[model samples]
Target: TVKPPVETVEVSPPETPLIPPEKERAPSEKVTPPLEVEERKEVEKQKEEEIEVEVSREEKEEEGKGELKRRPEEALERKAPERRFSIKTIFSPLTTITESIRKRKRRTTALEEVGPPLVKPKRVPRTLKEELPPADWRVLKEYEVRGGVAMIRIYLDPETSNYIYWVIEPPLSDVEKDNLKRLKDLLQVSLPYSLEAVEEERREKFLLEHLDKVMEDYRIKMSENSLEKVRYYIVRDFLGFNKIDPIMHDPHVEDISCDGPGIPIYLYHRDYGSIKTNVAFPTDEELDGFVVSLAQKCRKTISVANPILDATLPNGSRLNATYGREVTTRGSSFTIRKFREEPLTVVDLVENNTMSADMAAHFWLAVQYGESMIFAGGTASGKTSTMNAISIFIPPSSKIISIEDTREVNLPHENWIAGITRGGAEAERPGDIGMYDLLRAALRQRPEYVIVGEVRGKETMTMFQAMATGHTTYSTMHADSVKSIVYRLENPPIGIPRVLIQALNLVAIHKQLKVKEKRVRRITELVEIIDIEPTTLEIVTNQVFRWNPRTDTFVYGGHSNLYEKIMDMEDLSRDEVLEERDRRAEIISWMVKNGVRKFWDVARVVGEYYEDPHRTLSIIEKNPEVEGNPLEVFERAAEKGRKEHLKAKSVAA
Candidate 1:
């Protein structure tokens, strides 16, 4: 009554239902479709067959003969399951079925549009030929320095006929140079002003960190190769000797001489004589700055007010520099006699043909007997080197004192005192400690041996007095002959009495001259100071060994005053003393043959011989090279002896 009996209307069903009613049927039962559905299924089945046939024909064409072909039965089997699944799909929602059809079409279209995948070929790397060294120069040798960051190429210029020490470092690109400029500016502001206290190794680490920070802050994009190149330049300029850093690292270089600005730097190579280098200060300003820095490294100050600087660098190399044009005409000048880390030994002298083994053995005997001697030579004549080398011959137990203006004397003796002269701030040298003071203090200390680096001033008198007082004093002087040494000692600056000159036992005159077009250092004359002739009041000297220039060999004089002294001291005959000298010579020869040239290694050998002569000789009888480090055997023997002595002492206690 309310809605006209609900309008009793019936709704008819459509041709397809979303969810079809399931009829109970056996598992093997098959369902047949209506006419139009059967026709549609047949149309789909024909399309699928056509697609399969097309795929099979393409595959057969690709595989060619003897390849397996797809069978129709297998294709039918695979499609049968797909056809069965389609029936269930028919009852699916219209939206879902339409979405699936769209997806299939999209996949087909995408595949057709994309076609075959494109593969990019690898890029071929370019082979860059290294730039050839200058055509005018012939390369004598090329060796790496600075941990392989730089190379040293020694070239011979045929036109000029001069050897050039060329330093080859990594070439920086324009971008890298710009980055370096910015980074250096940033580092200069960030780093502390005084890095003198910082260790060399730590300074490099700090520099690397600062470089990284600068790059990050400015967002500098640089490749690792470029970064490394930039770092090398920074370290070389900041921590090292700038353009001359590579030359400094070369072990073969003995001296670096910078005459003036704009002049090619000259190097004294151990084998190649004095040679010009590719490195130079192109401007006076740069050379002045370098000279100032060198003075600072020596803990000294140099300015136009104080033009001359004579100081020792931290590495023990002697430095003599002039600050400005006020003194040096060209500009600033500097001379650096580089110090050798591994000091030359007696064995080294023999190996380098600087001296004969016989002379070294004679020095060995003289050093043992505490004979006072002086090495006289000009500048850079290797007088100091000879003294240092022969000093190893001093008995291991002797109390020795070495006094020098610079720290040049290095010894292996445990009971040794090394004294260096201290310069004063004022011109008068108010708080100065000179060699004279050091010599006096050394006398009070009661040293058996006194080594004076050089005798050029009042200290020569004190040294002679020390010699007279039975202190075996050795020194070096600027003299080429015995008479010159006497004259220099007895002159105004160093006025030693004629009698006092007799206290000196030996005088070694060293000279540097060319032999076979190569520079060589030779002990021109080994003269022994016998005594002062009463009639003429002149010093007497006996030539023990003389260098024959024509033969390039040392000639032995028939007799040596040193041998006579040794015989008198040991109460031995002349023949016996000569035999002992020969034995020592043989030992030095053995060391040279076995390449035992290190300072400590030679010291160990000499010390062992001093402790027990027969044992050292017996050990040498065997092939030391075959047995490995001769030091190990000596050390073990020494250790065993020490243990035995300690045990005996304990028992006694």
Candidate 2:
């Protein structure tokens, strides 16, 4: 039968196209819209030859019974073009369909949908064992089950908090303990070396080397529970600390302390102050073994004769342990003050509201101009972090010499000399280099800046002498307030003449506070030392900044004495110095706005700023994506610098 001419359908273009706004438009200008517009024209031209198709009643019925994943081809043609389908690309889905003569196959078939509603193969959940830490703690990873109780690691979740706490694992059942003993014996012959002898690099390799063979040989017929316990035991013993590996990985834990056996482990969390964990040793023997293993990892011997042990771990965390209750009264115990490889930056301090942008700006001016500053605070008050953050302001080219009991100060400057003190029984030869020795050596190196980790003993005298000779000194001291700083310096052991105290120009006291349940660290007092009072022998201090707890803000203490001193030394006016301060502040503010908080990244930016201040500042000024004052941050800083420059020239006349 002859059919009257078939009519083609004209499709409309979407209101919005799929192409990027500028990249597609920039080249041809009119090329983007033509695809949508021309496709309609092409379809309408072929309308006289177009043919329509029909579906059978049986097929339609089957499709209706099951859920349809895709719409009809006509509907697909309508929606697909609006999204990803680019008309120009010859290989596009729409292009393939429109170009082909054969009928398109349906994505979902009727037989396929009806054939046993597909069982979604269940996802194998992560076996709920503890996470394997990246470090090795092999001192006593493997154990034989002599008693009924076997230590099984279980992950704990505090019902009130989102944090997953790994507590002292609950004891295993009698049957489970027997399984662990059998598993240990099966794997015992294969182990090449003890945990202590296995190097850090070889620990992971050793565990993994034997893992597959052990599983294939022993894990084939084992139950999931028995298999899981064996795996946890293997990992806990080889790769991580039996009970505290999870705590070792926790970034929030500042300090981890174990007070002998049978007592709860205490942790000084950065935000929570002191939190007693659920993990503790059941026996003194177990505790002693762990402590000895830890000491071996630190490469130190802890004995009854040498009960007081202080050493550094492989990861650079500080370790202090006391054995035999000779001094600590508790059995062998340890307290590790976790070390941060990456130091805190100025941006971190500002974003946390520890210090204001202006106060930080003032600090920048002071640091650049060789101001001797000291961070004073109580224990765990963020004094070192504050000092480390602020030290970034020191000219990147300046030669810095850092002396510490144990290596701590990490600087980005290439011109840095690090000196660490060594003593105790190890100094039996009478030639162990102490902090005093390092300080004296640092001076002969002719460093522009001297950083003492902390001034405790005779080293205090040497540090003060360095400060007196125009070397910009930065140190941390254990003191509550600015007055206490003078007292500590003038007293015996540290015994500095009261007249020499004026050498210290800045004392920034950081404090740990509890505003509402949460622990916050902030600088409560920032003082500028005017001079030592000749008449009273008391320190003449001008309060430059004080933290306001009520508003959670920093109140600027008038203008700035340190800033004035900087201007005088640099031979610039008040306005010029203010401009310089603002300029430095804006650079820091820009960094905070962006996420340049890492020590190396922050140092890189600071180094670039030193190379070309205007270029660096302009790059920040032009980027609209970065958040800050924008007009105020740049214009005010630039204007102030220019004005100050003019004032300096006018005064020069």
The most accurate candidate by lDDT is 1
The pairs that clash in candidate 1 are none
Give the per-residue Cα lDDT of candidate 1 at 447.
95
- In angstroms, what RMSD does candidate 2 have relative to the true structure? 26.5
State which candidate has the highest TM-score.
Answer: 1
Task: State residue 522's C-alpha deviation in candidate 2, in Å.
Answer: 1.1
Off by over 4 Å in 1: 1-133, 424-427, 624-630, 633-653
lDDT of each: 0.76, 0.67
lDDT tens digits, residues 472-567, model 1? Answer: 988988998888888877788778888888888988999998999888889989999998889999777789999999998998999998887777
- Listed per model in order, the count of residue pairs whose N, CA or C atoms clash below 3 Å is 0, 2
For candidate 2, give the lDDT of residue 334: 89
